[model samples]
Target: MVRKIAAAAIAALFVPVVQAAGWEKLWTFEHGAGTSVAGQTSEILAFDSLNNELWVAGLKGVDILNAATGSFVQHIDTTAFGELNSVAIRNGVAAFAIAAPIKTDAGSVLTYDTTSRSFQQSYLVGALPDMVTFTADGRIMTANEGEPLARPGFATIEARGSISIIDTTKDSVTTLGFSGYDGTTGLGRIVSPGAKPSIDWEPEYIALSKDGQFAMVTLQEANAVAKIDLMSQQIVSVTSLGLKDHSLPGNELDTTDRDLPGNVSVAGNYRNAPVFGMYMPDTIASYASGGKTYYITANEGDSRNLEDFVNGEFNEEVRVGSSSYVLDPTAFPDAAALKATSNLGRLTVTTSGGDLDGDGDYDQIHVFGGRSFSILDENGNQVFDSGNQLEALLFADPALRALIDDGRSDNKGVEPEGVTVLELGDRTLAFIGFERTRQSVIAIYDVTNPTAATFVDFIVDADSLSPEGLSAYEFGGKYFLAVANEVSGTTSLFSITPVPEPETYAMLLAGLGLIGLAARRRRG
Candidate 1:
């Protein structure tokens, strides 16, 4: 259903007047329907404008859809390869990354001829190729996360993360490893405790520049972004996104969901707290603004702790009573206040950076992932951060706020997991998907002015929960958005149409008035 907000409500929320750019939901397809089966988590999506088809990568296999009607056309069984992780289409060939049947650390890319709808070839790639994208120069790229499995009797082999660059023309694959670079040398690195830049850094997502000259890869676990020179086929630099101060005004976040005993509250009373936040981005996209190329990131944090350091070890709750967690008593005058309000329960003096008095205890604490998206320059310098803009807007509007509660506040608030940018009629729009919310929402932003992006509208659907992949395309003279919802095992389609400007409405009214006046004169 299309959600509408009154002008008064918009003004109260300090948002721009609701535009008429109608985002109408066309249809939704359930998981395991048509070629897809139940329990197959649809993770990634790619649109084939040439054939008017949509390609989806799920647990079972790849499902193809008619882009116009959202109907299933075919399902490509990937039983030979393993589970399907990601999909991409270019030059009329659909490509998918399939994990190996027995090996968890190895995968292959299966390419199919869209016209013939038959398998063409399969190329071997690294373990857990999570994301796939095509460059302007016919090069298919995949970000191999190389995350080790966390199960008993699992292989103890350390999986080194790398980027697989496939030359579609030559049908050759080149693996570029990030192990060579250490903070001591060429590029500055963001070093977290127990995280070896070479071993622990996992490449999550890849975003190519418009010209395809450079590729920005998000090292999600490292809280850093790596710049890759496509021509040189090497990582040029890895810049760390420093911690965000949660004590600031726009950076305030609700620290807890268990406010009063047993009941879980949906509404988060956000407050400015003393802590540092890591910007561990999950999904990233690049766009050009002010004649320069920039990248946008959805800071959805993730970490793996199977072997070494346990997860949540640095949390304030775990370290508060420990003698090792020394605090600068002067910095935190009221130690009890810090303990009560801290989101992580306890503050760690060992891992986090700040040491005011140089005496053992930490003056500040750090946490994972900025709960919003950010715009960064080519060198990985942050240009503009959404900060609490997303959270504030969601909290202010009753309709949208009700969709997500404070349950996720202590974690990744509204978890902006997926992002994509599309240019529509001189406007550059950014679509962001929230993963943790009850009712999934694709928040639309007018990102043409990257510095001053305005929240335009939201595409809400109860069935579209946990949107894992999103792509926007213009086909048959209309713009369409496709979302892969993992939780409900479905795919949803929506059409976006620009709302007419106020001047257009005024001109129409004036022309009608003049026509009425002319008719009366003629009758008299």
Candidate 2:
């Protein structure tokens, strides 16, 4: 027991020191310090290589910063316009934001030309745009967070949510609208004013597949993620991550007596239901690995109880670390239909199977939570709902659980808003980022092995990293992680050099010795 205790102590010592050392402070950008139209930075940021710079968008106009020095480059004036909520840079031209005038029913999408250094074109968007992403083929996909339709005496009032897709080459933009909850089939669920009493349903963010054929969007106030098919323009998959049962008649706001799996049926007549069932999903990412496309979104929703329930201030604040969905692009009916209901599951990585490894293994998903970073399957089911065929759950240890739980606490690790899986040499590494709030961290995981994966400790910490939007790119034979910081109002470029593990180093030395001996033999 003494020996085991000593070993545990040694292991614990390695945790804080190593994790803290991994993150290196790259750069800091004070948005308003020296630049025009500067104030608090919004959580939305993006990279535009066409102009060879990083674009930071906030409540003010858009700021273009030098990617290398994190220096204040230039700011696009949107004062003639309105507050900027989203930005997209493509083909060397930048399109920042679209918004309505104060208390006015007017909004437009503004484009900034990198070559001319001028505002190029302005197109109309229906509602207030929150987030925007570039498609695989250079299309601009934007999402808004206002109610799309309104009706009195409706159980679930439709939140005016709009997604705008812009074809840059043709300068043509299409706007698609969706209401918060569609109860036509008696299948939709939502919160009542009496139950929630505080929250409102709205869309928050958007992301797209590599080919731009599919889009995964987050309805923040709605507390749901909808999968939209850009081709057919229909919502295909809708997943709710909040409580489902409702108390008041025609109300779907309710909670389970005990925490139940999100996909399972909730208890009937749940009380104290909130306005939206699911929490707010703040970020979204799309990646294609192992021949499957996955749409990952960040859930940063805060939970608050009704005023009458406690008569005091109490925040239940349930946040899903990070969740993802996978769907076949060909199976989607249209671009808009991608948000329709379908088979969707949480993104959990485990050796117990469920397609977590992309290997046809049945027992891959291990039951675990408190993960701010995750990768979803291209096939949808996080873990194949197989009977307990595997002997034991993979990575089913308390240490990992404790780490996740601690990391998920509001005061501990902030919301992991960005994630990307990149190919490092012959292996694959998952780059995860937690942002907003002051404490930001980036974690690197060696995910090469389908059954066994290694956490390379914390590769980046709060000191050097405050990642808002992260993308792993390869330039000049080196791996670079482009981090967009919301609070700092700057984006830094990080170089990820290959760090060989102890076993790999030992193997390399052994192979070299063997080669030297063979050469000596040949010489003799």
Candidate 3:
């Protein structure tokens, strides 16, 4: 349902939403449906700009999607190899993990040929593979989910989670241990304190900065994200978070403080805290725009109780809802302690806007929950709140009320998993991809306007697109959005073209020539 906000209010309020003609479905590949490797489909994995193809890895095989034709060009049958969990492509080579039947001991790192479209030998010895990435110097690295072994009471906790570096050129692997982690070597339930075994948290996913110099992986169990210096082959820092931060003054730390009834301390294996539920981050993304790098993470939801913890009776307070933590990970050790400091309210400062408080260069960010979305400026301050605005605008008109109610509807609302920016007309449109639905849908909003947004139609069939990972890149003057469908086991492609009126092009060309002439004069 398209709801219209007056162009006048959008201009006056400096809102970000601008109108687009409409979103049309481009194409869909049906070959991925029910495609399994080891009884599981190659869930959508990643898009490779270097190769101009989509990489889909699953329990059964890996399929390459041809971007131009929207068809599977090749498939690497892995039924003989094992179940695959993650896949990454770099320098025209794709490396992935093969998870076996059991959880803990199932991972093996394998490589694929982009030119030949064939599987290379598996790098077994140091292939502690969970998430795979390439170093700046072109070496393959796997953030080992550790040896996936069952935890004490809760069966599956296999990933003893660690990181291993593989020199693809030399075909050698080196283990880079995590700090404060020690447990059994293989599939066994054990924890020897001070194992200093390094990396205990189950690192679910890995993200690299544009330059590929910095790599960050999400550690679900440890409640942290580790930053690795690829070239140095060392971990620069680990940002640790937990429920202990949520507790109030008088709260107690007994079983009563947790969600799972009975002694949670004994559940010990998973470190399931009462208020934080499971404080593992499910996803991570990186963007470098306007001279700064930003890392964004999505936390499913917090179940721990902050009220009880803050009473100070409990050990920790659970800060539920979603959180946005931004900083230059490059400034470590000095800013290491700052990892604990979230701009809880308005901690960041914005240079472009009047939001400069002289603190960290914080740009405002927007967050959405089940019902609403919010934008907070750098001062750790909130600029506009949907819940608050809804209340105030409730008395506007019955039509407006209906529009708000419809927009806020449960089924229609999107759980945004990935966001990308595109230049549409004279403005930049933020294209947000949704989870919870297999259909590839893009929700467009003018980043310049927070209050106004346009929800576009879904890309492929609701039954066909189980998009999980999204990476946007431009090639040959055409824009493409690559989607990894984790469920259907394929990567779907979409082309984003900016439609500009004749007058718009004329204005842009005129502006460019003036800049070019000025540059020539300066050189003379």
Count of clashing residue pairs in every prediction: 11, 50, 65
The total number of steric clashes, by the backbone 3 Å criterion, in model 2 comes to: 50
**What TM-score does prediction 1 earn?**
0.85
lDDT of 3 by residue, 380-450 (tens): 12233222111112212222232222221212123344444555545444544545432444344333343
lDDT tens digits by residue: candidate 2, 1-524: 00000001111111110111122345656666555453746345666665556777766677777766777777776766876777777677676656776412435677777766786777776566766667767777777665332223333233345677777678787877544334232121233322220124445677676666787776654445667788876666666543312122222211221233443432221122211222245675555556666655444443223332334332232222222333223332341232222111221222211233453432221212222333334322221110110000101122222222221222212445566666766666666565533344555655454223334433333443356667676655766666666656555566666544322100112221110000000000
The TM-score obtained by model 2 is 0.61
Between prediction 1 and prediction 2, which has the larger TM-score? Answer: 1
Q: How accurate is candidate 2 locally (lDDT)?
A: 0.46
lDDT of 2 at 11: 10
On TM-score, who's better, 1 or 3? 1
User: Which stretches of candidate 1 lie above 4 Å from their native place?
Assistant: 1-20, 33-35, 102-104, 151-155, 183-195, 261-266, 307-330, 341-361, 502-524
> Candidate 3 regions off by >4 Å?
1-15, 18-24, 32-42, 48-52, 100-102, 125-128, 151-159, 180-199, 241-279, 301-432, 437-466, 488-491, 499-524
TM-score of each: 0.85, 0.61, 0.57
What is the descending lDDT order? 1, 2, 3
lDDT of 2 at 22: 25
Model 2 stretches astray by more than 4 angstroms? 1-26, 35-42, 103-106, 147-159, 168-171, 179-181, 184-189, 192-201, 241-280, 303-371, 379-413, 436-438, 446-454, 459-466, 488-490, 500-524
Model 1 Cα lDDT, one tens digit per residue, 359-421? 667787656678888999888999888777677666655556777667666666788899988
Task: Report the number of the highest-lDDT candidate.
Answer: 1
Quality of model 1 by C-alpha lDDT = 0.71
